[model samples]
Target: MFSKLFKSQSALRRFYSTATQNLTEKQEPKTYYKITLLRSAIALPKRYKDTLVTLGIHRRMQTVFHPHKPDIAGKILRVKELVQVENVPASAVRTKTEQRWERRPDPGFEVVGTWKNKRWLLDEEGI
Candidate 1:
């Protein structure tokens, strides 16, 4: 009975790993590391902050993308606890200007001759 259970567990593990592999194979290949800083490295060792600097992250919640290379992966692991990482395809990478445009707040509209504005003016005039 123990042999049967162990065999089943091994098979299940294999199935789980293969299923994830198949999904990745079907989807667009991940070529970039989307690294977003979630926590500050302040009060931590200088090495931690320096790793972030090397990765071009200066502020909390800042995101940067690097190619999926061994050295870049190592740097990411060094500060893994302070960041959120996602495997993104090359097309998902954006330029600095694009990121700024996406981050900027939407332009607001002017309230032109609305009923609320007219009511406010009349109220001030003792209407």
Candidate 2:
């Protein structure tokens, strides 16, 4: 029947739209750097320590994301012996807070309080 055919076509359209949306979300920005400190620069030359600091890596095993650029590439090359570098997609980068949130374990219990209810406590304490 024409109605059945029309329904299938509509479903196909919805499927195609969803697929395209997922593809777009997966698409990454032009270029990015995934820099991980493999070795510490302790006791090394001051230049090495300065380079690591410039790259935003504060310690060994720390990973930082940066945009791919000639200056950054030059800096990486300067301390290649102290780090492992790779190209990564933008979505792979995460902020410190996001990393903490990801590592946090969910509590089985829920917080059952509202600002309105707590307002009285604050008022009584003159806070």
Each model's lDDT: 0.92, 0.88
- Per-model TM values vs. the true structure: 0.62, 0.62
Q: Model 1: runs farther than 4 Å from truth? A: 1-27, 105-127
lDDT tens digits by residue: candidate 2, 46-94: 9999999999999888888889999999999999999998887788787
TM-score of 1: 0.62
Q: Give per-model CA RMSD.
A: 13.8, 6.6
Worst 10-residue lDDT window, candidate 1: 109-118
Query: Which candidate number maximizes lDDT?
Result: 1
After best superposition, candidate 1 residue 5: deviation in angstroms? 52
lDDT, residue 30, model 2: 44
